[model samples]
Target: MNKNLYIFKNKKRYRVNVRNYNQEDFEDLIDLQRKAFPPPFPPDLLWNHEQLTSHITRFSDGALCIEVDGQIAGSITSLRTNYANESHTWEQITSDGYITNHEDDGEVLYIVDICIDPDYRGLGLGKELMRAKYETVVYLGVKKLAGGSRMPGYKKVRDKLTIEAYYEKVVKGELDDPVVTFLMKSGRMPERLMKNYLEDEDSADCAVLMIWKNPFIT
Candidate 1:
């Protein structure tokens, strides 16, 4: 995993290794996580390379980090699971509980989280991080990808209050969900899948689940 990779630069671009996290990258990642999150989680919670790579290699589907201008800019984590016979199914939008007569042993991918520095926002770094995850999932034979978000309760109040309020007032407006916008722009998600998604944290929050059927999975 010690290979060199390069990203775009203005006058001159420097080359760096785009690889998995090691012991040395912990502090850098912690800083990035703090800047990316509104109320950043404690640094001690972030696992070291040995622990993280073990989680990915064993239970998780994919874990990745990006190096921009010779520094860690963002990261993404995803896992595989099957959700066929859960009895009661919760809707993605509206947070309504429902049951469907559907069944499949489909391979699922869960996007744990993703983040980039505020200065690096809108530079397509997040998209690249997502692409990295998608590629990993596609390679790993995962049929779908899903992620959960806070409705508008403690996580929101502790984090970005303004962004949370915007979602409440606008209700699915593009101004609030850049992640959804990214998924749509990539053509990886269906517009119809946004149903049952929660608006606030009170009831039940919806997780944005995107499915990508492998062309060779059948």
Candidate 2:
């Protein structure tokens, strides 16, 4: 892993830092989940101390955090694995987010978690965190960046539109899904939609399978 750190200044002039997350960041990271995922999303799904430790212990480079003025504002967690079974659910692939399935030499960098603090929106931190993930693909010599993005905004439109219609509109920018739209802007292309991909009720338990191929594939 390159251990490269990315820095910038947001509109408010707060220094933003994108770098690897350590055990000391567990508190901020956990609080971030409370703000990012809240109610309907299972609280159990949030990163626990054990899980945070597992991330760094198993693959430190796969865990990155974005800080603003030294305050953790965003996080992205990934694992290395091949996309053999498209039918696999989030729990199966990530061992319920513990990332126990981490494969050192897997072909793809599978992002299981990406969230920005609700207070930190409009800062482009999500995109920057994604850039770090893309960088991980290159630095770790992986094949691509892949993940099943949530559609938190789907629930709001479910009554007015079908799932397909919702997805289509989001892709066309006629509509916006919190996670899906953000990932799209970060250069991830939606490949397909899968049911029961996650336990997220906000997304109607559906997920958009997305990916970004590495241009410099070795």
Candidate 3:
């Protein structure tokens, strides 16, 4: 695949290339993931060296990284699955191991994870990465993008609202939720709220099940 370069002017002009992940990026990607996610999720939750290697080996194009000034600042890992009529849990999708559930002929692109370095936030890198995901969907002729959106803002108000209520507020624009807000703005609609989605304290043990259909699919 050819490398895709995205240039934008935020605080200042910058260039980033969204490309396939390479074996050499293993260590940097691991380090970036650590800084991107906050507490309650154990170290094991972060992909280790072996897991990273396994994913790249299984489906190279499914894993992508963003490079800024030649350094990896972000990444998005995904897998293809046939989920049209199936109900899945976070554990089941990610359970077989790191991207172990990847199916080459599947029609749905399941985004397993995404992370941007702290210093690179607010520069529109996340949006660019998401755009790249859509490009991948079109390239592979997939039907949709599906994944769990971590509710980083939930922890702050969990005591005051139920997960469902919180999601409703975010959807209704009554509250500013970090992950959900970004997902919504990126065209992903929330389908439901998932409990124990992952071990993140910020999300308060829940995730917003979101999906974005590929307009070019049908």
| C-alpha TM-scores of all predictions | 0.60, 0.92, 0.93
lDDT of 3 by residue, 122-206 (tens): 8778888888888888889989988988888988898999888988899899998988899889878888888877777777778
The lDDT values for all models are 0.50, 0.85, 0.82
**Whose TM-score is higher: candidate 1's or candidate 3's?**
3
Better of 1 and 2 by TM-score: 2
TM-score of candidate 2 versus the correct structure, residues matched by position: 0.92
> Candidate 3 local accuracy as lDDT?
0.82
Worst 10 residues of 1 by lDDT: 93-102
By lDDT, is 1 or 2 better? 2
Please list all clashing residue pairs in model 1, or write none if there are none.
Answer: 92-196, 92-197, 93-195, 93-196, 93-197, 94-196, 94-197, 95-196, 152-201
Question: What does the lDDT read for residue 67 in candidate 1?
Answer: 78
The true-versus-predicted C-alpha distance at residue 97 of model 3, in Å, is 4.5
Model 2 per-residue lDDT tens digits across residues 1-218: 32334344453466778888998899989999999888878988988999999999998988899888778899999999986337879998888888888998899899889988999888788888888888788877778988888888989988999888898899999998888988888899998888888888888888888998898974
lDDT of each residue in 112-200, candidate 1, tens digit only: 55667787665567666666666666767766565544333334343444443444433454343455556656545532322234433
Candidates ranked, most accurate by lDDT first: 2, 3, 1
